[model samples]
Target chain A: MDYVLELQDVSKTYGHGRTAVKANDRVNLQIQPGEIVLIMGPSGSGKTTLLSMAGLLLSTSSGIICVLGEQIDHASASHRAHMRLKTLGFVFQSYNLMESLTAIENVELVMNMAGVRGSRAKERARELLAMLGLGERLDHKPADLSGGEKQRVAIARALANDPPLILADEPTGNLDSKTGQEVMELLCCGLGRDQGRSIVIVTHDHRLRSIADRVLWLEDGQLSETDGNYLPEMT
Target chain B: MFKLAWRNLLHERARLIISVGGVALAVMLILLMAGIFAGSEEHAVAYIKRQPADLWLMQDGVENLHMSSSLLPPQVVEDVRGIAGVYQAVGLLYSTGAVDLGETEVYSYIFAVEKGAPFGGPWDLMEGAGSPGIDEVILDSDLAARYGLGLGDTVDLLGKQLRIAGLSEGTFGIATSITFVNKQTLAGLMGVPPDAASYVLIRPESDADRVQVADRLKEAIPEANLMTREAFVASDQEMIRQMGADVIRAMNSVAYVVGLLVIALTVYTATVERAREYGVLKAIGADTALLMRVVAAQAFISSGFGFLVGIPLAYGIGALITTLLPEMLIVIEPDNLLGQVPVLLAITAAASLLPLGRIIRLDPMTVFKG
Candidate 1:
């Protein structure tokens, strides 16, 4: 139970026989609680495929995936969703807050899905958004918020249910440099790590390595640790 | 979330209005068509439904008064009155023909009641006497007004000229206008003895058991069919509905189809518009049941609001019709409203299926694309 997420030799392949392409070839990774693991990879390196498998958003062709001591590789879709709601949270790159919902409501949605509703959920969502500097923008929809504000709302939503693990896919890809750095700092250093939550970030941003506890690189559907010798790339 | 579905509908205010409006109009159409049929049936059986008859005695095998010929001898009325528990019995002669109003001939049902009978038919008058005198007839006030005819004005009934002795109320419609005349005139016209009668209506004594009295009357007059008031009213309504209920049913089916299309199209388009949001929800721990709930909630919101709005609109239109066309009545009974609730719910449920399937099959991974 020390590791919040564990993936053992996970493999995913699209199609079969004559026209098979392996997206992840027996990838193995483990993320411990309160750890910031940054996944940097080239496009089509199957980084997203690996992240999706870890997040329980996609099924692995062959592997043992466990989240919070529960083996969910073969769980029913509903069960996996339940696991995701209770044990994991996600932050998308585009800040995919529902257009119809306000900033506070976007954050409250995950908690509501976990059956934490009414005023308790509302107060938690409010505290999360306020911590992320979205107190004044609580009533603003996705359309009204700036990119950085939207990403903060996404982070607030990701932490709304107080899940132990957070999976962020290019959380700052839509923001400018200063704004992106602030969002990353607020997500990984401010609220996430301080609250004993593990964070997994999949991105092409090399500058994000400074805050990460471990920076790993994905290439050709395989994972490898990037030492100081790794070259920096433009996001 | 249901709140999410509701907000999604509310976000597009114009589409929401159009969607709910479409459903409301369809519901109104169906209810109005049904109300019209019910109103017509009520009008056709006005005499039977309005009268306080405990039992009806007609010629053997004549089950209804509308479009039925029942020739009971006048002695049957006296025989029914003589039965224990029988308070009073009145006889009537019925015929169907057009009334010659000099300028225009209006199709009507002509009934001949006894001149001094207190318990005969819907003998209520709006402006004139309650019963017709010798060589006199009682016509609907609306019909008399339409032709510039009034009390003491003459109308030709079966080629016999008779004065309009009284003008009756609620006896006119698009069809089935009633004209009441004295039994002596009708008997003389049909070349039958004045004592002959077509049907007999009986009122049971206040403290008597109607079933026992009806049995005794039936035994005494085997040549006549005996029916309680409820059976008689139902039979008349059945005959009246046969004339137009099929058209009403067909119209109602079309309206329901319109409602289905409106709800389905709006929900389908709304789902497609929010496909990415739905994908986000799916990726973030929303199960198929939750997605289905959102879709179903949207459909029910549209249909439930539409139905709630339709009832008042139907009543408003009914009032407008009553004012503009006094002879036409629109009867939207509580039973009618209660009956349509299941139909609307079923339509809403059916409307949700397409969008539900669309979202259930959506891959949450698609939200990762951009």
Candidate 2:
């Protein structure tokens, strides 16, 4: 398999000297196209740290991180940021939509920064919003939308650049089970399911286990895959 | 984009309206106060500009005719005319007297000039016959209408019966309405006797520099004060500079400080409301330069609205002042206007900087933490 995201012996240390603590200890992982890898770990098991390093939000202390064939661990801040914006899309636990903008404007905000402009950019945003079931709520402000509607708007914003890799950090952590399921289904139902796009989800929710094709267990700064048919040992 | 900036401004129309209104009101008041100060200076120096004298010889230590007393020998005019480059000199007697026309008692200034000099009297006759003949006088239109007096009308001036010879406009000075008469008539009216005049006004034969002439004349008569026409006008303005300047500065300071405060508050509130929005923008790949541009665009929008409202409002205030205070024309000098717009722009630009610094440093990750 041609892996889209690969990490080799990655190590991350939180502090210096006596207070030093290792988050991700020489961990190795690979995610290929059309793969949904769910990262499961107990509290303080370095799952978020690993995801952060993978998403280019945090730097690893040692080892190589390659995303879209670019070595990000040794890259410049702007270079890594560029990679994050072009090749990666983020859906955070909190649906961070700009309250001042309408639903379509929040999505268009991403496209605007991506240097997409004029009528074509606007039409693309409209189509994206319509695809996310937000066509009628384009003019409605965030305060006027429900929890699920806001999350859908955030999802639309994340997909604005048509990036090939999606990194979701507890995307449904704040939602009810039904709404979480709905958002996850919306994310997985289309191109994410059939097309060759990679998805890495950081979650501890057992309910989301059935949707992911593979589940990676992270504990004591190590990772191993578990079968989807059996319950994995916690921590 | 500029369209986004414009829409953001319009979206908060009420708040933006209040902000622009504050700036416009400040601009109007600043222009009006400056006009009043200019008007006062012009009123104080009106006669000095009109006088055709190359030099004025008055009593030693006298600064201006309005603010100082000048005593000189009446024979000084003849002595100054004998100096080289001196063509003709006139002995002028400046004094104040009341003219009583039965129902109205009008205070009038009397300027006594030698009979043959060019600076003999006022100009632009309106309704009367001509220059004051022997024992006659000139009355301005306002004074004439108020006193119901016209040509050949007998007026009691300083206990002597005088006749109205002509009507004119702008014949009033800082003291009161001016009446032109010969030296003999004025000397008799003021009871100064024959030996003394107020000052000697001299005209150079050629267009010689008045400062050189004044110096030479001062050397000839050490007991007298020498002044050029420009110096005389400047001295006259000192009284207005003393009177209206403090008031103008105070008014401008109040308007400027209040305008700055309003701009600061407006920008601060707007930035506070958009803090989360700024974070979202950063997360979406907008850089610091792009964020600053959006903020500057918003300021431009606010200032443009203020300019649209302020410039016209300043003119209207000037017109209203001129109409209500007819004797005064609110003069907005070029320097005063040039200084004000930039001050407003500076306040606006500075106001934006404070909030921009706050917005630029905000991290997008913090928004996710929320």
Instruction: Give per-model TM-scores.
Output: 0.90, 0.69
Residue B58 lDDT in candidate 2? 90
Error of 1 at B27 (Å): 2.6
Task: Tell me, by DockQ, which candidate is best.
Answer: 1
Against the true structure, candidate 1 reaches a TM-score of 0.90
The DockQ scores of all candidates, in the order shown, are 0.67, 0.25
Q: Model 2: per-residue lDDT, tens digit, A54-105?
A: 8776788999999867677988766765676677777878787766578887
True contacts kept of each: 0.64, 0.22
Best candidate, lDDT: 1
Candidate 2 residue pairs in clash (backbone atoms < 3 Å): none
Model 2 misplaced stretches (Cα beyond 4 Å): A1-29, A40-53, A58-64, A73-81, A173-179, A191-195, A204-207, A217-224, A228-235, B11-14, B47-257, B316-329, B333-335
Stretches of candidate 1 off by over 4 Å are A16-19, A232-235, B77-88, B100-106, B119-122, B127-137, B147-166, B188-191, B203-220, B238-247
